[model samples]
Target: MKRRAWIVWLPPVLSGAFLIALWYAGRAATGLQSWILPTPGEIFQAAWNEHATLLRAAGGTAVGALGGFLVAALAGLAIALVLGGARWLRTGLYPWLLVVQMTPVIVVAPIIVLWAGPGLPGIITVTFLISFFPIVVNTTQGLLSAEAPMVDLFRMYGATRWQELQLLRLPSAMPYFLAGLRIAATLAPIGAIFGEYLVGNASGGTGGLGFLVYVYNTQIKIPALFATALTSCLLGFIFVAAVSWLNWALLHHWHDSFERHDR
Candidate 1:
């Protein structure tokens, strides 16, 4: 199984390597001009030269993403709980929730900036807008989708509303919550970057990767810009992998999703 996993990864690794070779060849063919595309070596050199600055940008972006994700998780849980407990509230609010999701973050971000006036608060608002929806939707579905018989049994045994929520509904919702979290982990970085693009500032000189991308592009440091962009992508992927591992660990014991047996 381990070997199979490695084998699966091998193709993508090789493909990336091949693409880099092609890129280098193209740069060579074009004489490594800055007006044209930069060579792999030049890009690597640029990245190395700006490694500290790039690292700082990466750290800032991660902080914003995580901060926003934390807020979203809490807010989503609260919203899901309210929806679960009150059918009328769910009916009234669900459509609006969907509307919020349908609206593009780019369009809403400027409004958020106007409301918040700027800085991390504005960025976090954008991040929250983008990351909160999946959590609420998935968690609400999980909470309300409890087995009818199981709920009846709980009621028969005199389970209070709070007891039912704590023991039955919340437990039932765990898998769905984790699934949403995995999605959020991937999305948070994107939200942060999008927010940064609008806000154009992060905590101090450690502005997020998007700001760095803007600066590098203006300076015509195409290679450095690409490197910073790639770094953000890699950061998002790392969060994805972390969430996947967490999901596997959390669900492997009881959930059929982790079953290794034949269907």
Candidate 2:
């Protein structure tokens, strides 16, 4: 198992290393100005120098992402449940959810910023908007996709609707719910970053990693900008990996996705 993971990770690690080496070679060969294309050494130095600032920005972004994710997960599940009870409601709301996802964030972000007073609330709203869709869609599918035989057995046992949902449907939904969560976890950062970049909150507060990127870009600090961007990607990967691990631990023994692989 450990070997398999190392094998899976090897390509990405090697690819990243090769890309960095190529970047270094290109930067060194061109002797381009630092602002134009920073060498790996310069980017490393910038990262080291700005570590504290970057850490704080990362923290703020993480907090908003987590808060928004939690709120979305709870509300999304409840909404899905309500919709599950009524086919008409599900059909009605389904299109709207699709519409919301289809709408570009750029068009909606300023309005959110204006209504929410910017900063964390605006970021959270954006994050929620981006994250909620997956949860609703996945959980609803899971809840409704309970195996027919099992559902029939529950009905034979004279199971109440709520009882059947609690004992049978929800358990069946766990894997799907986690899958959506894993997707949502990474998306939260994207939503938060988009919010920050679009609104440019007037609080004069340092916005977050996205803001950090904008600042570095504006200041012509190529290396620092790349470093911050890399950090944001790392944060996103971490979120996805964490959720994947949690899903494995929770469902590996019972869920087919993990169990079949284990076999």
Candidate 3:
């Protein structure tokens, strides 16, 4: 297990090292100034200097993303439940859902920010909008994808729709639901940042990463800009890692995907 864990981590570690080396080499080769492009060392220094501000901003973004993700998860599941129940609902509403999703986030964000008053509420709403569609799609498919034999057996036993859903369909859908969450996890932080960029003005120290990105770029703080960008990537990575852990915890024992490793 230790060996496997180490092996799993090795590639990324090496890749990161290689990238750092390349960053150095590229800067040396091009003779670019720090203002135009900062070195990794310079970025690290800026991040350390701005650690308090960055940490606070990241916390605010985290709150917004988590709040939005929770709302999206609950609402998405409820919608999926309704849509999965009847073919008519699926046919009528699903197409509309597609249309809503096809609409760009950029187009809708400003409108939401205006209504929600450029605050945490607005940020959460934007995040929810960005992360909503996949969960509904996946959960609806999972509900409908329950094994026919199991569904028939429940029907034969005179089970109600709710009972069947609770006993068989939801359990079947768990994997799919988690899959959708995994995708959302990657996206929620981005939405939060975007919201911040547009309307996250409730700043005590740091408004949010997106706002900081704007600040750093306009001020020509290249190293801090890179640091902020790296922080955003780390936040997304943490969210993804959390979802992956959830998947393993929920599916490791019974899911065929993991069962092979037991052998």
Candidate 4:
């Protein structure tokens, strides 16, 4: 158990240490100005000094990302269900879905802001666009991946379409949906930040971490900028970790997806 724990924890610890060392070394070697590249200490101090503002900005970003993730998950699941249930619809719509996914969000953000009037709605729309495709594709694949024999058994048992879906298909899709959700959670923040970058504080306010990042950048506050970025990274890590825990909790019992190979 200790070895297992070490294997899981060591790499990240080492990597973080290495990064800190490198940052310190580079600062000492190059004698870079604080604005060019502040030391980790400077960044930490900035973070401590601006804790309240940073926390509020981080909270806004987190909320936007979470809200967008929920919206994407629901919409993706609904679309997947429609496509999975109707072969003709799947055949016709699948290609278009790919096109939607392929389209860059940068190109789409302005259009969304135009329609949504540049605020939380626009940010949420950008987040939704950025994170929507994976869930749709994964859930559709999962729903369709039901074992043939199981499906046949259901049919033979005179199971209704809804019954087949509820009993077999949806459960089979859970792992895939969860996997997509993990990916979506990570991407959601990026989408929210990008939206803020493009739209500014469109809600007639200072907005989220993205806006803070912009403000710090333009004002040449490198330590604060790094601190803001680190905060964003921490947020992403938390969101991903939360989803991973949920995945393990939900799937570890029956699903082979979470089965312990060592066991």
Candidate 5:
């Protein structure tokens, strides 16, 4: 298991290291000032120096992001199940779902913030809005993707719609649902950060990372700005890694995608 985990991680680690080295080398070759383009080293230094502030901001952001993600995951799954179970409702409302997804988040975020109020509620609402659509889309596709022959066999056995859905469709859709979740997990932090930038209030002496980004940028703390950016990336990576782990845990035993890995 440890060996397999290393195999999973080694390529990305190597690639990221190479990229960082190249970024540093390129900046050195360009003769740019730190204010213009901070190197990875400088960014690390700044992150370490401002660790207290960064950690505080990260904690605040994490709460909002996780809060929103949990809501989206539950609501998205429930809504998808409802839509999938009813053909008439799906036919009538599916387009509307698409329209909602099509609407730019930036356009609606302020309105959501205004309605939900600032701080945690507003943050969670923004995150849920950003992360909800993909779950519905992917899960719907999966529910619809069940094999025709198998479904007919179930029907021949006089299986009820609920029985067919519970036994056949839901199991088949697990991979797709997890795929959507992984995608949404990546977006959760961005939603949280954006929410913070727009309407976040300070909690425990620190604003969210989005607010910190603005602060650092306006203060012309270039290294700190870069550090904040790196911190956001780190947060995103954690979300993704967690979902990936969940995906592996659920699917590895039976799914074709992870079959080889199981051995």
Candidate 6:
């Protein structure tokens, strides 16, 4: 168990250490001004100094991301199910979904902000738009990917459409849905932060990490900007980790995709 744990953790630990070392070495060698490229230590110090404010901002961003993720997950699943069940619907709507996916979030975000107004709603909308595509596509594929033999068996057994969907399609799609969720976990924060950049509290008193990033950048507080950006990355890491944990908990026992095999 201990060996396995070490094997799992060692790569990330080493990578982090190596990156930090290189960062330190590059800054030491360059003798750059803090404003141009703040050293990692300076960024860390800035984060530490403004820990309270940063934490609050992180919390706000997290809330928006989490809310958007939940909404996206539910809506994506429903859309996938509908599209997967109906050939006509799939043909009609799937192309439009593709168009939406291709449309840049930068283009849509401002429109959302204009229509929804500045704050959490616009942020959540952006987050949902940015993160929901993978879920829909993956889930639709999964739902349709059920083995023909198995589907024939179910039909032969007199299974109703709803029964087949509930018992076979949903179970088959679990891994794909979770995989999409993992991708969305990283994306949700990006959407939230981007939205905040556009529509966050203009007063800057209470907003998300996105707002902090904007404020720090405009003020030319390089270390603080780096710190805020780091915080956003950390949030994405945490979200991905949580999704991975959930995936393991839910799928490890039954799903071949998640099953561990000792070499």
Candidate-wise lDDT, in order = 0.84, 0.83, 0.89, 0.88, 0.88, 0.89
lDDT of 4 by residue, 1-263 (tens): 65578888899999999999999999999998988889999999999998898999988888878878889999999999998988999999999998988998788777887897686888888889899999998999999999999999999999999999999999999999998999998999888887777774756544689999888888988899999998989989988998999999999899976667666
Candidate with the larger lDDT of 2 and 3: 3
Alpha-carbon TM-score of each model against the true structure: 0.89, 0.91, 0.94, 0.94, 0.89, 0.93
- Tens digit of per-residue lDDT, candidate 5, span 80-153: 88888779989998898888888987787778767897788888888888898899889988898899999999
lDDT of 3 at 5: 88
**Candidate 3's residue-wise lDDT over 122-191, tens digit each?**
8888898899889999999999898889989999999998899899999999999999999999999999
Model 3 lDDT, residue 87, Cα:
99
User: Roughly what TM-score does model 2 have, to 2 decimal places?
Assistant: 0.91
Off by over 4 Å in 4: 261-263
TM-score result, candidate 3 = 0.94
For candidate 1, the TM-score is 0.89
Clashes of 2: 0
Each model's backbone clash number:
0, 0, 0, 0, 0, 0
lDDT of 5: 0.88
Candidate 2 lDDT (Cα, 0 to 1): 0.83
Clashing pairs in 6: none
Per-residue lDDT of candidate 6, residues 161-193 (tens digit): 999999999999999999999999999999889
